[model samples]
Target: MGFNPRDAIESVKDIATNAVERSADIVDSAGHILKGDVSGGVEGIVSSSMDIATHSVYKIKEIATGRGDDLDEIV
Candidate 1:
């Protein structure tokens, strides 16, 4: 059996093509994961901020209407 240089070159090309394709896939997957994590974090922060603002507004309204007074008046 004789070693053919052409066959060896073709085999090397195939290996290189597969490696490049796999690397691209890995990078794409990582990008998707990062985007999901960042999106979730931003959503959480916005939700928490809205909840705090709602509570603060409720408390302000109560105080303004004298409903939060703790002192008793002598009539």
Candidate 2:
């Protein structure tokens, strides 16, 4: 077959388009994974902080009412 310039240009264009599409897909997948990991980490940290705060408040209440002596029993 004859090597036509127009055909060669079209082939190059198609290859470039495919490469760009694949790269975009890879970036999109990576972004989703990173977002999920960050969201989960943030949720865990919030839960742990709330637990610590609740425990601290309970301890403060006990100490204020002279029930600190029974701390071990309550726990």
In terms of TM-score, which candidate is strongest? Answer: 2
On residues 1-75, what C-alpha lDDT tens digit does candidate 2 reach at each position?
A: 344556555555655555565556555555655778666555555554555555555545454443434556665
Alpha-carbon deviation at 36 in model 1, angstroms: 3.7
Clashing pairs in 1: none
Candidate lDDT (C-alpha), each: 0.50, 0.54
Q: Which regions of candidate 2 fall more than 4 Å away from where they truly are?
A: 36-75
TM-score of each: 0.40, 0.41
Error of 1 at 73 (Å): 97
Error of 1 at 71 (Å): 88
